[model samples]
Target chain A: MERERICFTLNNSPVEIHCHPGERLVDVLREQLDLTGTKEGCGQGECGACTVLLDGRAVNSCLVLIGQVAERSVLTIEGLAAGGKLDPLQTAFVTEGAVQCGYCTPGMIISAKALLMEKQNPTEAEIKEAIAGNLCRCTGYIKIIKAVQTAASARLEG
Target chain B: MQDQVVGSSPVKVDAKDKATGATKYPGDLRVPGMLYGKLLYSPSAHAKIIGIGLADAWQVPGVRAVLTANDVPGHNGHGVIIPHQPVMARDLVRSVNDVLVAVAAETMAAAEEALRKVKIELVELPAVFDATAAMAEGAPLVHPEGNILSHHKIRRGDMAEGWARAAAVVENTYRTQMVDHAFLQTEAALAEIDDGGILVLHVATQYPHWDRKELSRALGMPEDMIRVVGGSVGGAFGGREDMSLQVQAALLAMHTGRPVKIVCTREESFHAHSKRHAMVMHYRTGATGEGRLTAVEATIIGDTGAYASWGTNVLRKAAVHATGPYIVPNVKVDAYAVYTNNPFAGAMRGFGAAQPAVAYEGQMDEVARVLGLHPFAVRWQNAMTEGCITATGQVLESGVGLRATMEKAGSLVGWDVSKING
Candidate 1:
């Protein structure tokens, strides 16, 4: 395999790495960059556990090749919080008791961040629609929906 | 301090870590000079292994070590309750998930390449698929000990007495399908020698102490020699209660003298771990004209697959709970865990109790239909109260809140709990 160097802005910071063109972004993030926030529940991309924002749009990091992300800014769970302060969505998830096994939290928060970036005050149906791809076996999705709504309301108040 | 926390909602200890992606699951762990491990599984559910060729796999440049059944230094199997499941199948392969070979290499790519190079020869054998069919006299034996892994029964009161007092009866059979835990994080583990030269195993498992016992038995090492660090588990339900990637990774780590990490793909995760028992339950529930349950007789046949992972505990629990939360005077429950050539069933969300609910509850609905009583009314009538004895002879002494729950549910849906006097 031909080794290629890819450059991308991560969490508003520019970063570069040398990897194979077809290597999964999830692997590059976890194994190479040492950013373990993006979880890989299903490598097939069916499960949204490895979701990350590719230019502010949530995409399955496991499906996106490292080379495909060249010159684009990517956002992960680690990048959501700013200036050592907890993001509203992260605070909401913690307070709402939405993080159960915590394996799906990173992806869940990233997906929510992508939605709130576009829509400030998303309806419950809109929140549900955004997180439809993300599956949480715990909490029955009730507390999760509530958390998303709570975060959206926080954004509206701010 | 303990008393203060008892009645209050305590924030989960790991919730913050989980929300921030700070917890490191076994798959996310990284150590310098770590090798990746890969496993080769049997192609057929039931087969006789003719040969396993490791020559070509060992020839791979980045390959560290390729191990087969013969390389296992101690006992080959790794089951917790019954050590019948072979970590590496030698002569017989009872299930398709059975591991035939394990390879350790510098890169996961190399490990995958090595696994592709290793060849296995097998002759397919006749396999029984279900629990009931496997119990027949002429059925192919999944194990030499016979197809019945375990049989649990709760014989309470006389069957004649139970059948005689019945005003209305419901008899029907219920079948439950096999279910996977589908935990967000697939099975992953890293095995390496610490500074003290002891094996330290990092894994996402429900029970680390149990892992110690089984790993000791399989590795032929003392329990102290093995150290298991609990990785931040994503979601187990009941899937991580058994050994999956612990043994093979440890073996490779010990042999190659390197930190060996093995992370299963989604497909491999489905195969490597145990599943929930797919049960076949036949229920005959009898009740009086006033909706008081007289008796409940059930025969539960759980398809435990190839080996008895947690079959004994599962079937016994199923037998104990066959009558549900109702009060029945006379009850008989016979639950069997039978061996089949499908995926081995271990622990799940409900163990084995969930399957019988489909039957007993259906029977309750049918009994209510025949007696022309409201279903909730019938449930309220037969609900287990304080001081009531269970079918398994356990007396409900205190905190028997079945009726209290029904009262709240009754109010929620506008059911008149006080007005329903049968």
Candidate 2:
């Protein structure tokens, strides 16, 4: 119930907020910093809709409290694009028709970003296993998988 | 043939915003002086409302308004087709998800705490859950009307002659359970009285016109006075076809003179919307030794649950498609939808037509096994042609492509029809 000043690096920018330490990172990002790209599908952490990068590692923002995010680097869907250009994963999703309703797009792209960061050439099964935490009802995950493959191939051929 | 988009996939207009998370869903949007709204649901499945003590809820510091069924400004009920569902349980609670009271507070915590302060008394009643049993004599009435919500039947050709020509008869019973759509995002809505005193609603829904119509009924306002706007929905798949908290949020906003938003948690979302209907189907399909021409009889019972959302239309389609895409000279189908104390069932992927494939198609496989004929051979023999008449007595005059599709599927699956059937 106590409110205090919380500091963290958000989207490559240093930010500070005065809020309860136990508040969820997803809530803090959306309500405090106005980073609404971090979605909250299931608050219980079962769904990866609130996925964000914590020090370059994908984590569900809903599960991490503001206290855990203190002094840590976080990246959200809004930050995935740089210099007004969409990330390759996002572009691949658009071209592959991987989006429907799009609630899971942010988390899917974030997880894919984390995967491609770790391995430039991940196998198809590894790509599926990487995004296994993120659930998508539409697209049946076929388009999403294809989008990831397309993005990886584009990176390889670029 | 001269079209640019017919043979190619085009980028969706909303895809960029959706991927970037720039698209604001109902929950993401906020206005000045907005309050969080929460509703108190029934604990018992069926009960008689004794009293609603709301004084304690109003005593909360930030709680602006605590409303019960009696506080509704206009009509108290809302439903997709029938206006029989009580927005807030007035005299009776029909299901476990029935709303008893609503609270509006500056913060979600305050609203939740205010919800705990409201007191409701109820007398639990007998309940029915099974469709077939609910139709029996002396069953507890879920509604004032009888348990049977709708009955659809199909009868064509002579059963005696068709049965006499059959060499193999397959009879079996199949049942499907209630299935949830489980879209990634739950239900959320925001309602506010705009500058012009018109209520502007932002919601995740499949149909905004229906929302406007139902809101008009619940708020006692003219249709023109309401403006419904669609939000960035996660997924609907028929789940957003009915009202969740559209009326409750509007009423709270109307009373508090501020914007009101209600977001249903995953638990509440499961109970809020109608799911795919659970069906019990019985089919008696007969075919000759050559896997051609006979009679098909089917009886399907669908449990519509607490309210009839789209049960009538669903069961009708079930009966119409009970025989599947095959041609049977004589056909008989009796499909019934019934009311029960369970959660309501409505539109999903198939409405009611998808479940019967287990029965008729199962019968097809059984005939194939009994006659030692290839599965494709049996289906190919009974495939409906252009002039075939459906069980509902509708004749397909043109563009009936069942035979053509079967040929394509057969070749794709390496089914050689020349050596198997002929």
Candidate 1: CAPRI quality band: high
Q: Each prediction's DockQ?
A: 0.81, 0.81
For residues B34-133, could you state the per-residue lDDT of candidate 1 as single tens digits?
A: 9999998888999999999889999998999899888787888878688878878999999977999999999999999999998889999999998999
Superposed Cα deviation of residue B135, candidate 2 (Å): 0.6
Which regions in candidate 2 have their CA more than 4 angstroms from the true location?
B1-3
By summed lDDT, the worst window of 10 consecutive residues in model 2 chain B runs over B1-10
Colliding pairs, model 2 = none
- Model 1 error, position B26 (Å): 0.7
Q: What are the Cα lDDT values of the candidates?
A: 0.90, 0.89
**Per-residue lDDT of A25 in model 1:** 93
DockQ of candidate 2 is 0.81
